[model samples]
Target: MLTKKLNRFNTLRNQILTVFLFVMTVVLLFVGVTTFHVVSTLLKNNAEEQIEQTVTQANGRLEALYKQLDGLTNQITTNMYVQQMLLKEVNGDYLGFRERQNLQQLVNSFQTYSDGIQSFELYTSNYKRVFPLDEIDLVNRLGIHWVKQAEEAKGKMVWIGRDPKSPHFFVVLRQIRLMDRWFSPGGYLLVRINPEYFQFTDFITSKTKKQGYMLVADRDLTPIFSNFVGDSKEILHAQQRTVQQNGEEYIVVKQTSPLTGWVLMIVTPVSALTDGVAILKNTILFSGAIGFLIFFIFSLFLSTMVTQPILKLTKAMQRGKDGELRPSPPISSTVEINELNDTYNALVENINHLIQVVYEKELVRSRAELKALQAQINPHFLFNTLDALYWSLVEKEEEELAQVVLNMSELFRYTVSNSKQDEWVTLYEEIEHIRRYMEIMKLRWGDRLLWNIVIPASCFDIRIPKLLIQPLVENAVLHGIGNKTDLGIVWVTVEDCHESSDIVIKVADDGYGMDEQTKEKVNELLNNKEVSSAKGSGMALVNVNKRLQLYYGEERKLVIHSELGQGTVVLLKIPKSGEE
Candidate 1:
């Protein structure tokens, strides 16, 4: 009898121990996952915030550098010796050897005032000259010809090219015109600036110790100065090839000088700016893991105390499954476990209610997604209609009819090709779609519809959104010229608006145009306002307007100008291609 009692006691203890280990493992796992996720998110956000702050500091430093350079250029332009050289009379003729020596003395005096200047040269339209000693023979020996460019530039300041005298310098040529005639031929003032003057290392040396690099690139993405020395040609090429790069996140601040034609680029590496945040993330992860391990060990000890009474109750519940409602065990270690037991029983009673709620929510979400998919069916329907029309014309042995159908089919294909979300199509693709649309219209209306598309070759490769222009053209045919009695003329033109920094597309039609009331209705729709019930169908125009506003902003919306008898002209002011 004693041995049997001992065996039952040991069996009960082993069951309690197993339940304790299982509960502790579950609690520790939940804590670990929750801690890790919360800490990781916080670390990432802090890192990004820190990086933004560093970028702001770097931008400030670069702006200061730009200001300093501008001041330096102004100083050189106003130097007394430079002014004296500008005042000298050349009479459109070559300077004597003695006169060249005097000009060299002036250049040397100006060079003494600024250490950044590597060299200076003077050249006239009639004769090429060098300063600080006549090096015309040497210039001829080296085959350096900058005199032609000075004449081409006339009286304006121009960056001729990379310096032939010294590869490390960039030559700035300021043509000096005579004050009396202004047309009288004058000499050129050539100033060579050392590349090291713009190098960021002189000011950003302290930041480099904290993991930062500053670099300056020209408008062509040619590296003018860099913190590290080597051939940066490949990096410069990569920067020019794409607006952004993979595996490298950088912030580029550009300062363009109208006076100098120089595009100063300030580049800050993201890694240097966010290194502190990376360290913080690693620290948090390490500490959280250590905390989880300690909590796991502590929970194991605590579970041993809590699971004894629960094990007894669990076994009683198992017995109840066989139709015996035995009472639970008496006397637990803590009130929390007793409360947990009560909660679990309540949850079991209402499990069906929770399941019903989850199922209903999921069903509602699925129905919403189905409705969204249903709304996208119109484009597919239109494409199918065009395909059917094409095949029907082909079967009837009508060549012109078949060609028109095919063109319409191609137009719809281009419109529905939305596989790429951020795809930038060439201007040529846009023109091709317009051509297909016009061909279809010509076949439908015969000689009644007249169209002229004038697009320059320079605008062909510019990137625009796919199907951007065709929609307006379609609207013109469907609404503007569809009801016109006499021959209708539609003119489409693409031109560069350099002053506005954009490409202007003008679509003008000499057909029956809208009155003031109808024009106001169209304007309301373009502004995303609801039209009055009396106003007619404007769905296509509204859709086009919304899409343009979505892709670009309100500033890039379509501008309409029209009169009752003067017809209508639609002007689209889209940003130039390759802009950020």
Candidate 2:
């Protein structure tokens, strides 16, 4: 009986070990297969994405080149010098010798001003070449075709046959307008453009690794210029294949010059553009392979050790999940494993305590600061002053003055309503405040102070630091207009600048503008080391500058421009934030 019992125990242990090994093997296979598929799929998608980005960059470069060439052509044709040369006497003959000489000079000027020109010439209305007789036969022949086309299409420039001087030359012809008739032979301004001028070799070779070639072609599908040397048939076939199969992966930019009926085409291969993407794809694949190998081996060792502690700890975790805080079984293998468990528990406790402490402190501080700010000033003083002004105006029997006092009181109320905090006000609200202040000034100074306010509707919604504009207006009125004997004009304008994403508020006063010495004194006061008290001169401007810096950083600050006896303009450049 004792032997049978021992044998039964051994048999049970062997069966459990066999089951564990089988489960581990299955898990390893699943993990390895899944990781491989996911990583491989990710690498392929990333490669395609990189290829698309390369195509976009290539398109941009091509577009830039096309634009540069188009601009150069347009500048040449429209140049005052070229136009004058076209109008000059050709030789000394009214319509013959002098005309030929002028035409020759114009050809020389075109060649000198522009590079990559294989030839330049001029043709008369009768198919007679007037200049550059070297290509006279070719010009006369091409001129017949263009002259016929020019008759049907009036006033428009036409491109004639392939250039004769350069193997890859393209010609542009414009009918020069004379005083009399539209079709009267005005002579053609012919230019021969080398296709090599537009070939961007650096971009193509660097991107395509010399495997791909770039070529410029005319509307006839004939290659004007090519960077790669090969049989024409092979080159054409490769180009056709690339265009048909992987055209989407390539970049093609076409620009037509309105001045000259010439088309600029730029073509770049996708593979050349995104060579980095291919490299990146390979790097990721290699790294993923190495990582998988390392992980697979490490997983084998880790799996066996993982199960025993996991089972023991999982049982304890299950108890906690059921609402019992039980300690996990101590892992005895490594010191790091034991420390991880301890640290996790300690971190959770510390976090919970810290959250509670922060919540309590915030609530306490909010209440205390609000109380302290509110206790600084009283509302009764402002109310009593307004009431006295109202009574005085009533006694004087001035209804407008009493109304102005009421408006001023309302303005003051809005300003002091949020005294406890610095707030942002809409440009419209600031403008309204300034208008109220201006009204009060108008009542005091009458016709002596003339004010003009120009504000755009778009700038009305932009937010500014509260009370920003009012201080500047106050400074202008008190120190500027009040001290001047001459009648003054105060201009306030608000400009909305969408490009720079800013709103500019400008206030100018044409009264007693500061001299250089006075300006220097004011600047000194603004940047003075003394606290807010010693900087009495232009204190309002200084305060505004400080507040602007504090809220909007150093970039946004008050700018002052003043000329003695001329005017002073204060510009405030504020970023447009829609927040009220």
Candidate 3:
């Protein structure tokens, strides 16, 4: 019972289901783990990239603000009115009233920039006079620190650092140049901008709220503006880095403004970026478990559907061991499984039909063999009886009749003896049989059927099929000499030597030869495969041709040449070694 149970477990269906389940489990587990790792890595990378891009965009905006301030400063310093006024030859002088009014109008035109620019100041070098003289106090007149920085800038714009008196102050300074000479500065222009005018809130979106913050700092690593307060030198200067602060991990990304020499830094918390990944991980785990359960059931169903038909076919084949074929039950599954079922169902019927056909054929073959044996016996008896009659005719002194009986009996004996063995004999034995047949033919036609045998002595011992030459001789007498009115010569010639393995034999007759149609018909009979059982007196050539081919193959067979009123030549090629 235990062995039987184990065998049942080992059946093809059970084994297939087991393997399918095992493979599916392995594949699903692999997919789950790979998917988790890939999605987690993807989410983290996307978060880092988004943070970096935000910082870079904020940096670009800050750079644009700096460019705008620089443009304003350039415009004031390069104004033709201001340039020509500063270039006047006065050693120590004040601008004329009209020049002062023109400069004031230029300053007033820029009043709309009050959002970022606090004020514009112009200091002329010739008189050391400042623009907006009405608003300047006597005590705070020149701003010597800014003036020195503006002198250092020459004709270029420069960012002036915060003034100690005004902590929130940002200034851009530039030297005014003369009309014709670039290096000769006419005066200076200074523009003050409020740092609070920059919108840091633009970099922080609601989706990223509490996830990260940004900072803008100067080249000196001092903060110009910051949403998250920090004084760390690394955060201000580092390009991209990871840092731990207050027991929390953060990713820092930074971008530099080319116009202001300031750095834009983004500080992002690692947990805030990856906090949603934990839920994703749990969801994926649940989905994987559920997927495995579904796959297990699917594999069982698939394996059962695939293997059930095969098992049924196998059982039917096993029952066929006793020479019985049983039809397997039909299965409804894939096309190939159904095909197998149909094939097995038809197998028994085909096998039984074949058996019946083979039995009937064997029965017919047996009867044919019996009739053939009986026929062979009749020929043997006839030959023996004719031999006895030949002796009796010799005793009565009838030499001609006795010679005819002897020749006929000899031909019959040779044919019957060889029919039993289908044996090979020496060319000399075949020649003797042909001579006897020719003698009988000569007696029938007298001298008109003249014959010659010119075979070489060397060829006499060559082995050949028995009675191979007699049929050709009979064909010659009947078709060639028998129908001729004048004296006809039938010549049999053979060429053989020790130097060659092939023996050539030719039979030529000078008699009434065949016409084209007759020649073709005779050739067809010789070439036909069924010539062995061919009927009629013309079968002599066909039988000889068939026997030669059977023994020496098709190449060593009879060839005939005949023509009307010209004579006939039959050529036969035989191997010296006969059929191998």
Candidate 4:
């Protein structure tokens, strides 16, 4: 009988607990398996970051030292006194006894530039001079291999790695030009360095000091020096950063210095990276089961209380569903049920009122649409009337008057077409439409009003909201320069802003500009969304601003730049096709 009961699916308690247990077990297993992988990935990333940071820090210091050494070379080479001596030698003139004494003292003074100067020697085609002549020449002293490098570099400094005699020191060689002329090879200046003052290894963070070791290599990747316990050449020349030697895995990270063209690398064992991850991941998965068990017990206890409130709410909803629509009884046991009851009560109270309100809104919307249609009237009727006026003037032999009337007819024809609810027009159509409007304005103002349109023909195919630029042109004519007697120029330019993937249209007029207060007011009016529709050119400005925002977004609003006497420039940007 116990086995039959266990096999049977009967009570909600048994069914719920069994399904919940299966789900929680699957979830816990998934969390445990994935947690180990996630922790491993995180540790690897942190290790790579640590090693890379160490290499960068150490390389940065080394590059700084090299730059300082380069600076010292510049200081001694460009010294005016040095230039005079080099020129004298390049001219094949022998130095007098007094001049040679002066040259030695001048070379002796260079020791003050850096304390790392192990030896300073200058070689000329005519003769040779050394600061401390007792010290053997390390530059040419170790064969002419370094001298050839310096000679090949012309006048630039050539950096050779370490001195084979004393590995702790390095050498720099340069073939000095005659008075800074590259064509004239005057002499060679060689300086041996003791890097104790500049070569710094402590820049690497102390935390990583034990995990890995760093090495600085020249452009050819020859290792200058390293702290590796084993051979450094095997790891340095490996094709891949991850290497295995003596049955152990190691990871390498490298960064090349731009200043010195040297490679900085860090090498560490793979074991050090995954040191604590296994223990931490195991601890997390172990504690997770205990925590979930406690949660399961509490959830079962809470499940018993949930059904009562649900049953009460169900009965209330059942009565409403049967045409007794009314408020549900109040519930305070859970915030969810309490809020559900409050929402249902509010819906019951507001349903009839909402229906009536929607009906009224529809009625108002229909009336508005009807008024808009009536206001549009018919464009053809107006067009016919303007046609009659144009012909009447033509019959009287008034050619210019007839032409002005014809342009006016075309301008109004385009403006009235906008009332037909057309939203998009090719930019070419927009510019052409404004051409007629400006012609009419110009014919009225004569020489006082002049205009120019500069738009790439390529941009003519782009579609924009109808009449976008007309209002700006109209504002420039009627508001900006309409009252000024002096000749005012209105420039309309459209540029394809490739960087931003937008088109910028500028309408600028050099007229008596607005005062600070009025300009502020006009700007506020353009940005104010609550503005009511009004008549005249001002409303036209607002409508254009509103349409730009509606078609694009809030960021597409018109930008106005103006000052007291510099006039005003209105800038508007239209995003490319997909940008909208």
TM per model? 0.41, 0.37, 0.46, 0.43
Which ranges of candidate 3 are over 4 A from the true structure? 1-213, 218-222, 229-234, 237-375, 378-410, 418-421, 440-450, 461-463, 483-488, 497-502, 512-537, 546-559, 562-567, 575-577
lDDT by residue (tens digit), candidate 2, 446-559 = 888988888888778777767888888888888789887778878899888878877788988987788999888778766652335333568888777766654565466678
Clashes of each: 0, 12, 0, 0
| Model 1 TM-score, 2 decimals | 0.41
Ranking by lDDT: 4, 3, 1, 2
Pairs clashing in candidate 1? none
Model 1, 1-580: lDDT tens digits are 9999877767544555556556656665676667656765665456445444544555565556555544554454455554445445454344556766875775566667555677766655344564545447423522345555555766555554467657778766665665554555555566777876565554444544444445556555655666633334544444442234456655433444444434444345556545665666676668667866676566556655666767766876786577555455444567876776665566544554444445543453354346445544787787788788878888898878888878877776665454444346888888898999899888878899999999888788888876667777877887788878888888889988767778889888887788999899888877753322232456556655654654565455788888897788888877776333
State the RMSD for candidate 1: 48.0
Model 3 lDDT tens row, 111-179: 586577777777665425456665453125436665666677777887665644576876666778776
Question: Model 1: how far is 167 from its true place, Å?
Answer: 1.5
Worst 10 residues of 3 by lDDT: 134-143
Give model 2's TM-score versus the native structure.
0.37
Error of 3 at 579 (Å): 2.2
Tens digits of per-residue lDDT, candidate 4, 273-387, equal 8886768776877777786787689657665566567667778778877867677778767898788778878887786455544554345345445755665577578789889
> What ranges in model 1 sit over 4 Å off?
1-88, 92-105, 135-154, 180-185, 202-210, 229-231, 239-278, 308-580
| Candidate 2 colliding pairs, count | 12
Top candidate, metric lDDT: 4
- The candidate 1 region of ten consecutive residues with least summed lDDT is 528-537
lDDT of 4: 0.75
